[model samples]
Target: MSETETIYDQIEIEDFTFDPDTQLFTYPCPCGDRFQISIYDLQDGENIAVCPSCSLMCEIIFDEIDLQEYLDQIS
Candidate 1:
């Protein structure tokens, strides 16, 4: 399937919880787990967040500038 077709949903970056220690952004998944993606992966232009307990993935919506600003604050 195409990338757009495979995404379970599109979630805004602000809705996710960021763990500074692991540098991971996460959101609740329907499968009783969290969908996770690394900040480094996002910086590299990867936006898909996957749940470890199931076959669900979501596309993260974010602006590059906002991401950079967040990183700057955390740094």
Candidate 2:
């Protein structure tokens, strides 16, 4: 049987690279919301994400996600 992933274990920060010119990285979040977090705020395995679109904040420590899916949407 396939294992089920819980909300607390289904997302993560794959890419946190920032553009020096913009100093901001718009990450594609799969939680029905988009996050435009500062590159400085993005840390490996760290949660507490600040969503710019919805303006809602959340965190993720062990949330796993399909990195490619988000990468495709990110620009």
Best by lDDT: 1
**What TM-scores do the predictions have?**
0.87, 0.35
lDDT (Cα, tens digit) per residue for candidate 2, span 1-75: 113422222234555433456645545555676555544444344455556555455443333353334434554
lDDT of 2 at 53: 57
For candidate 1, lDDT tens digit of each residue in 23-73? 899999998999999888999999999999998999999988768856865
Against the hidden true structure, what lDDT does model 1 obtain?
A: 0.89
Clashing pairs in 2: 10-63, 10-64, 11-63, 11-64, 47-60, 48-59
Candidate 2 segments whose C-alpha is farther than 4 A from its true place: 1-10, 30-33, 42-47, 58-75
Q: How far is candidate 1 from the true structure (C-alpha RMSD, Å)?
A: 2.1
RMSDs, each prediction?
A: 2.1, 9.9
Model 2 RMSD vs true structure: 9.9
lDDT of each: 0.89, 0.46
Q: In model 2, what lDDT does residue 10 have?
A: 26
What stretches of model 1 exceed 4 Å from their correct place? 1-5
